[model samples]
Target chain A: MTENNEYAVECEGLGRVYRSRSLLGQSRETVALQDLNLQIPKGTVFGVLGPNGAGKTTTIRILSTLLSATTGTARVLGYDVVKEGREVRKNIGIILGGDRGFYGRLTGKENLRYFAALNHIKPRDTDRIIDDSLAQAGLADQQKTLVEQYSRGMKQRLHVARGLLTDPGVVFMDEPTLGLDPLGAQELRQRIPALVGQGKTVLLTTHYMFEADSLCSRIAIINKGKLVALGTPAEIKRNFSSIGVIELTLNQTRPSLQEELTGLDGVKRATTSADGVYQKLTVHVVAGADLSDKIAEVVGKDHIENMVARDPTLEEAYLEIID
Target chain B: MRNFFVQAYLSYRGLFLWLNWTAYISNVVLRPILMLLMFALVGKFAADSDAAQAYMIGMIGYAIPVILLGGILQSFVYERVFGTISFIYSSPGSRVAVFFSRGVLHFPNSILACALSFLFGWLVLSLDLSTLNWWTMIVSVLLTAAACTAFALFLGNFTMMLGEFFNLYNAAMGLFLAMTGVIIPIASLPWFFGDLANGIPLTHGLVALRGAFAGMDIGAVRDELLLEALVGLGYAIAGIVVYMLVERDARARSSLERSPA
Candidate 1:
């Protein structure tokens, strides 16, 4: 009778409301998530893209059974996240953001062993699993070092090691590359696809649009605690094909120049940025509209240093949707 | 059972593996001896020979419970402050196992503290031990540890539920210390306070331990040991129930990821 057994994770009408009391004794309710729906297919990397307070962490917390939903239901691997929490926990690994979660006094290998024990991984396999995890996280050489002595990137890798100790079928990573350097982030990104290649499902949350576009098989965009769009990266990009984007740089852009360009008949949207020396402008054109004459008529060619027009990237499409 | 021991050992390592040899020695040995000396000096001037003997035995008997229970309570607070409580809660293991695992470190520490304190009092204080019943003392010390551990487990759950209550709980340790009759007789207090002492674990434990240390016959202290064990059982059940309830509430409130504090 289940609707989405083939999916690794499915949630319907998921909502969470936090209650707080003010000094005046008036109760205030903050809705962290509301009427959210999601379905992550098995063995695929699914990305949840959103700004902060957009319910990304709340969704992961609910799916991991670390928090209960106020309305609706969520399931993982055909088991209800709330009703069969233990079963859900058994099949999933979680890595939340921040470096404060682990015991700094423990060694990297020791932390993995502790989590492995807590997860009830077989005793005979504990050593093998820990060694494999440490190696996978690129910490085998430094496994004996205390966690407090590790750099931020090393600790983040240790988080990955801890998450993989159980070999979970599904992994929830909330902003896993949040504080890492570019090289560290690239290395972690390389490891995520391997998990999916092994028939594991990865649910990743990130604010970085490029990361989502390149790493995820499907991307879901959430804004203000609501899902605004859900589709594959190509599909999301294709949705904006009716519009064209133009990049225009000026020696110095005046405030009135941007207003006049925005007021042009064929221009759909105009965004401007001034870098003190040069003004960079992005202009979106409506489909089937010729904006060259309109741009020429609005501002003289002398004001424009360089101008090029092209299709939108995922980031542009995202800004178009959210803005 | 294997998981329990593994967890216990890992947790012990987490709290102590980073310490240097001297810090480790101080933590496990020197600190307890110093505490015993301070108590011995207090007993020397405060009362007559008979009262001083009672004070020495009472302090030595209850030292482990106070030290270990206090440490267990502080570790729970530190777990919340360090943001690891959420990690433990999200694990697939039973909450009971995690609670006991995190609290188990203090178990051996308590036993060692009691032994060192006992030795220090016996040697430096020159207390008469001719009639001491080693078997009964051993049993009483273990029972006292169990009872106090059970009590700390309850407090751990309570402080975990309301994170800010940790400060209040830490400040109340003195109240529990005074009420447990370690340094003062429970009977000397008013009737209400004396009756309240019966509800706290370790009061009867201290009474039974005093009997063992004074070389009283086991028959004379059998009732105290039984009462101590029964109290321990009651708190164990109550502690488990409270833990489950608070854990459920925390899950509902989304407090596990970040404590209310």
Candidate 2:
């Protein structure tokens, strides 16, 4: 693939295969990613959503030049990730958010200073740049505290600050909000648009459907190392907009209830999950299907406590695509 | 150039947790001194004052490799364990600067350990200082510590690749103690073992150190000192080559964050 100005990140037929040999001389190969093609436009938040082990991190690692692709090519800001790795690295920042990346004994500011040096930031500019990044991540007040003493949310924010130390044009964030409270996640989610405002293209991988829906201008859903769905959140949901959902909270349920509902005329898929003393049954149907009366008859109205009908959510749409 | 020193200082302070006053005094200072006294006393009980002095100088030579090797290896090990090695590899920083900086603080630390060991030998073991050539002794100590630090940097790549710090540390310590004439004269060993000893760092440096303590001039042990310097340079070059190769392999195999199981 050749470099393109319009796209901040590009990949063509990208694939990665991991091979391992056992002590007993047995070998196994795992295809973490394969034939993955993506062209993320400049100055946009491109979200990649995938289930666990779906190669989201593999993609990030390759684009960040941390791992080379086994086959095909990837470029960050027109630099080939493999052949021109140094140039690629110079123009991109990576944040693999987790509790493990920081030196616990070092203060947050000291850690940033070390990484700043690693990024080749000049000594004269290091403090100013670090201060700006810390303030941007809302970590200025706690910059002097040891990282081990910081809460998990604070560590995550520090990861973001570190990634922006060089002010790279493209940033790759792998699960930046994986383990945070609702408030902490919300605070981080709010920081995404500001990055775009600064004209930085962000490629974010997340498991949160709503976060993707709200923040990403375009989202790609990958499964089994392949791009299964790609579109704006609304467009993705629009594809499944013709499907309606009917939910029933019942006092009890039998194993046959799902099979019985799946056999209904307009029912596309049926699933049941237990919540405390109640069994919640969700049925997907074609638009305008009024199967509630028939479902009540099948389930027996005495066993049903409540019923509601609604349009499919982004999460529901994502589940349908993945399934 | 400034970035190199900044990285070296920050990494040394950040990764080497034992730099705290308590751990430093206990692990770095007291531990080595106590070991030196114990071994020198053993020699005294076994033979006489001359034997004890030999053992004391030998133990002093051994102290540099132990401190320097462990310090350098621990830096690499902590980088891996803390998962920061991936960030370092992923950056656009100069690999030369990053690689060599790991030894910057460690070299001086090794020198300090050597000085402490000598002080303890004089104060506790009653090692004679009158016959010591201060100038040559300083040169020997500096060269010996540099050689040991370079050797540690060479082995540090293995610590990063294998993720078995203690295993490599113990094996290296064992090899140096037995083969580098730390306690035994290399000449007395088998011819094959002597040949092996020629390749290990500090073997010649220790000889030059003993020569310096015997009041020999730099000209007298010049060959050994030169050989020591050459050995250190060889290991340093070998270390850089190994690091580049391992880095390439890690990028290919996606194993930079941790060693593959």
Candidate 3:
């Protein structure tokens, strides 16, 4: 039972279909996670990246045992999500569905203790465990305050405290920093890495690329119910950058001239703005191909006012995978 | 067994806690006082008689059905509304355990408020309890209390089915003054009024209480008492069945597991 091959999460072709009643009272189905096989190493921060309705929440819910998979197998900490759910729940802490927490009537400290009591943690240890969790979440000073009184940032911090109350081996933080200001988001960004220092694995999902690239050791990008890319953020960016996109704001070149320039050697494609003077174009170059001189030759040097070469970021890499 | 004890303890605690609610206390006192006021006014209008005095003596039993059913019905609706039922469902416990636990939760306050309210009615009307018929009526009170509580299981199930809790509470409450034969015995009424009264579970329980109140012949009253108990139990079972069916559907329909990223 010692930890040789500890995977915090493992899924093989896991999928979920969410059905809702249509306007006509019939059912409509939306595929959430589709045939997704992913593994998160123990003690690593794994980020799931996607746009809205990309199934990030569905995947997290399955891993946390809040939902059953429509098909395929999912295991968390070596326990089957469906069969051994209790064991899975015992070892994992989940902050479900971004900020859907805390009874409005109860104080922050009370809410955490109630969940802890439900988890069957001994009553005598309640105060100590709660204090420790709040301290860890940086909410120790304000533990006594009612949740309804807390600001948005304070509530997010309280949710983190609640998630960490069990000191479980893993935490599934779904949109943990959503609806937060830059300062609060930054502070949370700092706090998450500290959990990794405690050897706790975190499965985080976010639409924000900076959060994924900055916080996660590995990232998975999903779109339309399929996992499109999975690897280190840097590796993803380097691998998928096929076209170099440059925005050339022209002072003199006409629409027809820009169209003609697109057929020039080394100039892969040109797209002009509707007014027809300025255009943003992507050039497909041979690997290691340098076509700056040829591009400059096609669009006369005098005509190009602002030649800005936008280096592709993770967002671009993600778009390339999903597109 | 641990989960069972925990559930039972929570239910027991729930009942005791409900005893502190202002609504429960006010309703318990209000029902009997209003009945007393209605009687004092009506008795003065019509010729006063021992039988009318007996009706006042008997109205105590009316509170039993209201107290017990009110207690059971409201708690079920409230818990469902507060998302407590959802939390209980997600817990690693049997659905039967949670359902039964809720019944246990409403019983204590229902029983206590009922016993106290019946006693308080005796203070207002000053009816002599030496009659064996009255003693039988007391037994009938206890039995009918259980019957009303069981009947409330249906309202609780109905509350879940509609996906709203308090509206059921209000509906149960709104029908209380009319449905239960607290005011007049169904057998005393003529034709369709009697039929409508006989059809309701409250009608049977009220009849049994009234029979106990006046020493109506056992052979004549046995049918109504038996119907009360049987119908109450039947409705309770139906309620549980409805709750169980909806529980399965609710779990299947759950989309709350979504996490925003």
Best by DockQ: 2
Taking the tens digit of each residue's C-alpha lDDT, what string does model 1 give over B1-261?
Answer: 898989877776664332457765775577667766766677777756666677777767666765665566656656666577677777788778877776677777788878887887778787668788888888888888888888887787766655644475545557556887887789888669999898888788889888887787767889998888888888878888887787788788866557444
Among residues 3 or more apart in sequence or in different chains, the pairs in candidate 3 whose N, CA or C atoms overlap within 3 Å are: A57-B259
Off by over 4 Å in 3: A1-5, A20-27, A97-100, A240-311, B1-116, B123-158, B170-181, B184-247, B255-261
Best by TM-score: 2
Better of 2 and 3 by DockQ: 2
Which lDDT tens digits does candidate 3 get at residues A174-231?
8988877787788878978888999889999988888888999999888888988889
TM-score of 1: 0.92
After superposing candidate 1 on the true structure, give the runs of residues whose Cα lies further than 4 Å from its correct spot: A240-243, A248-256, A266-281, A286-289, A296-308, B15-35, B162-172, B259-261
> Residue B44 of model 1: what lDDT?
73
The best-first sequence of candidates by DockQ reads 2, 1, 3
Candidate 1 residue-wise lDDT, A86-196, digit = tens: 899889998886777777888888888888888998999999999998988889999999888989888888888887778899999999998888987998999899899
Sorted by TM-score, highest first, which candidate order results? Answer: 2, 1, 3
Place model 1 in a CAPRI quality band. Answer: medium
Task: Write the number of the candidate with greater TM-score, choosing between 1 and 2.
Answer: 2
Candidate 2 residue-wise lDDT, A1-323, digit = tens: 76689999999999999999999989999999989999999999999988999999999999998888999898899989888999988988888888878889889999999999988998999999999999988889999999999998899989889988999899999998877778768888898898899999999999988989999999988888988888889888776456778999999888898899889899988888987899999999887888889988888899999999987888988887787
The best candidate by lDDT is 2
| Ten contiguous residues with the weakest lDDT in model 1 chain A | A235-244
**Candidate 3, position A152, lDDT:** 75
Q: How far out, in Å, is residue B224 in model 2?
A: 1.2
